[model samples]
Target: MPLIRVESLTKIYSSTKEGFAGIREVSFEVNEGEVVGVIGRSGCGKTTLLRCIAGFESSDSGKILLDGKSVSRPGPDRFMIFQGLDQLFPWLSLRGNLIFAMKTVNKDANMKELQRKAEYYLELVGLSEWGDCYPYQLSGGMKQRAFLARALSVNPRLLLLDEPFGSLDALGRKAMQDLLLRLWGKTGTTIILVTHDIDECIRLSDRILVFTKGTLKFNLINPLPRPRMSEDPAYMDFYGKISRILEKDANLKWANAVLR
Candidate 1:
């Protein structure tokens, strides 16, 4: 059975005007230990779809079943790491931020166990020494690391990442992508990552779901081998195919913008 399933999922926002819809009939599934990417142009319901799976938004007409159980509210089984580092509490230290989730969910957690889990996750995200540091003292990447550590510390069965690296510059974003890939490999967590970056999607996902005009346009599976290189023949072929699809979807409007 799929780890998570979205069946005929649809969400519509309240509209004063007669003809505005949010998301219509978006559906997909992420199997156990699978990393899936949701790719689309901006305002195409990528983030909205992630929000629905995370239970941040209720669906208008469908069901979200995790391991065959219905999801109605936010739960620890599915954790979301949003696009902003501001999601982490500024006042809490990194360790405190991680421990807070444990304290909330595992009421019987003792100090030693909490510290052990926090340190384990911090080390997992390469932040072992920064546990006592506040969010303000860290750089943008460090703050993102803390956010990642906190999320991993929770040990959620499924992780929802909504453009988590969208704020970083080129190098920083690449590093975070590498880090995310490593974490996914080690933890074997089911993830649905929504990103505007097509290369990132192809590099990290087992499959890619293209969202367009509030619907799932297509699903592409990545059959390339591990440690994929940009120059690899198979990678280039898949990239070119996706580029053509996106280009057609763009209606040839950005003819000047080269996709490479």
Candidate 2:
């Protein structure tokens, strides 16, 4: 059975002048242990979809089912890592932040056991030595890594990521991508990643979903093998195809706006 099933999901913001539908009748399923990437331009409803699945946003119509149960509110079963590095508390050390998250969801968990899990996840993200460091003391990349560790420490059934590496420098982004791959390999966590970076999506996703104007435009499987290289002919070909699709969509959107 699919781990997550989003059926005809629609979320409209009435606050907007024209009542914008952030996501319009979107439907998709994510299988267990699958890494799905959502790619789209800004304001295209990628993040809205993730929020609906995470139960942070209520859908105007449609349903989100996880493990055959309807998702109604934010729960420990799903954890999100947003774009900002400010997710971590400045007053708390890295380890403390992770431990607190774990305890928040699993109140019956022993403090010592939570600490052990926190340390393990910290080391998994290559932040073992920085556990005692505050969020302010870490670099942007380090702060992101800590957030990832905290999210993973709870062993969530589904991980939702919204452009988690979008704010980093080129080098920092690359490092975080590699770190994420390694961590995913170890944890086998089902993930839904929303990103503007096409290369990053292709590199990390088992399947890619393209969104345009609050609608799903394409659903493509990644034919490339693991440890994908940019120089590979197949990789470049797939990249061009996706780029062209996005370009075409952009042009269409511009033309429609001009006509209106």
Which candidate ranks first by lDDT, i.e. highest?
A: 2
- Each model's lDDT: 0.86, 0.90
TM-score, structure 1 vs. true: 0.93
lDDT of 1: 0.86
Model 2 CA deviation exceeding 4 Å by range: 14-21, 251-260
Best candidate (score: TM-score): 2
State every prediction's TM-score relative to the real structure: 0.93, 0.94
Write model 1 residue lDDT over 33-139, tens digit each, in one string.
99999888787788778788888999889999999999978999988988664877788989999999888888898989999999999999888999998888999
Q: Which regions of candidate 1 are displaced past 4 Å?
A: 14-20, 251-260
TM-score of 2: 0.94
How many angstroms is residue 135 displaced in model 1 relative to the true structure, after the best TM-score fit? 0.3
